[model samples]
Structures are given as structure tokens and as C-alpha cells.
Target: MVTRIAKCTCGQLQIVVEGEPLGVGVCHCFACQSRTGSVFAALAAFSPDYRVSGRATDYIRTGDQGARFRFRFCPVCGSNLYHTEEGEEHRSVAVAVGAFADPDFPPPQDSVYDCRRHRWVKLPDGVTVYEKDPE
Candidate 1:
């Protein structure tokens, strides 16, 4: 029942996640790289029942798999905070792991879209990797 707090770069938007996350993963798809402007994006998924205490803006994008995703970001610093996929049961939301700024936070257990993974990027040992989405 540990609660974790995630915040945007500017600290204007804060989210409080209750209990534990359903899953944690890293995505190395082209879309994720472009959206995050990084080699990969790390996320911690929760049951969309968290509490938010600030304003955010939503940006919608279509994934390569043809699924629609709504990305939520802090309006002040434009830091991507969380996202939700279309038709997702439980309305699960994946929060940016970096937003927590806590090294103690659980690490990613899985890696997706590894086909697009950078050649130099090395994942920790024993992590489950997929060439594409696990689904």
C-alpha cells in the first residue's frame, strides 16, 4: 500500500498513485522515441484511479498498431506525464517513470518494440523483451 508521487518537470502537475503499479516497462518504438525525444521511454502503469492536483493537456496520436493513444502532459513545462490507449479495459494509464525522480522506484520488468531499440542501448539482465507489443 505504498503511495508514490510523480510530478512534471516544472512541478506544476503532480499525480499521486495509490498502492502498487500493475506493470512497468520500457518502449523503444520509433513513436516512443519521437514523442519522448529519447532512445526509449520508461513507464509505470496504474489503474487510472490516481489523483491529480494540477492542470495538463492531452495530445492524441495513433500508434503504429493503429491504436489511438491520448498522451497527457503538463501544460507549463510540456513534460509528458501519462497516456492511455483506446479501448483499454481498466482504463490503465502509464506514467512516465522519470517523472517520479526516484531511483528507488521499481525498474522496468519488460521491454517492448525492441526491433527499434538502439544498438547501444543495453537493458538489464533477465528483463522480458518483445519485438513488438506483447499483446
Candidate 2:
């Protein structure tokens, strides 16, 4: 299994993920835009086997579907590092792909909430596009 380290902007929080991610995707929902302060968020999903170290803070918010999301950020630099959704199976946690700072990391396989995606934002070719979350 390959291992990768993801760290907060100030290096105050670090996470070590074992093996490749289960999936990678992009989200363009309003909530994601607000949380990321960007047009979209690129995420890599990992199972519960990942380990986190150092100090971090969490912000809990309810989504449009009434699903709760817990966002974890660095206490020092306030960089959003990862998040977990309520009742998600496999104890999956979605981490900010930017945290890895690896240009060679695999591209996202899915782009969701395309309905809210900015008209100027260009998605990579060949990704599965969803108007909303895939059921």
C-alpha cells in the first residue's frame, strides 16, 4: 500500500493516509463553494484507516438535504483539511486534494452538482458529470 501525507497550511495538522484513495471527485454545490471559498472543491476519499495527528478544529453544518457535515481545519492557519458526512458508510473521509501538493495525483473521476457549476469553470475531459449526487 502506498502512503501519503497531507498537512495543513501552517503545518499544525497532519494526516497520513494508507493505500490509494477509494475515489476522487469534484463538488460544485453552493455549500462546497462557501466552504472552500472557491468555484469548486476537489476531494479524495479515504477509508477510516487514515491517521491524523496534531491540533485541528471542526465546524459542523447541515447541508441542503439535512445531512450533517463535519469540516476539520487547522487551528493555526485555518486551512480546511478534511470532512466527513453524517451516516456515510465505510467511515469515509474526504480530504482536500490540494493538501497533498502533488501535481501527479490522479485526476477526479466525477464532477457533481454540475447544475451549480460555474459556466466559466472547465471540467476535465471524460469525467462522469452529475447534476447532483449520484444515487
Relative to the unseen true structure, what is the C-alpha lDDT of residue 98 in candidate 2, on a scale of 0 to 100? 96
Q: Model 1 RMSD to the real structure?
A: 1.3
**lDDT (10s digit) by residue, model 1, range 49-109:** 8888899899999877688998989999999998889788367878999999988888889
Error of 1 at 20 (Å): 1.4
List pairs with backbone clashes in candidate 2. Answer: none
TM-scores of all candidate predictions against the true structure: 0.94, 0.93
In candidate 2, clashing pairs total 0
lDDT values, one for every candidate? 0.90, 0.91
Which residue pairs collide, candidate 1? none
RMSD of each candidate relative to the true structure: 1.3, 1.3
**Model 1 weakest lDDT span, ten residues long:** 84-93
- The Cα error of candidate 2 at residue 76, in Å, is 0.9
RMSD of 2: 1.3
Q: Residue 97 CA error for candidate 1 (Å)?
A: 0.3
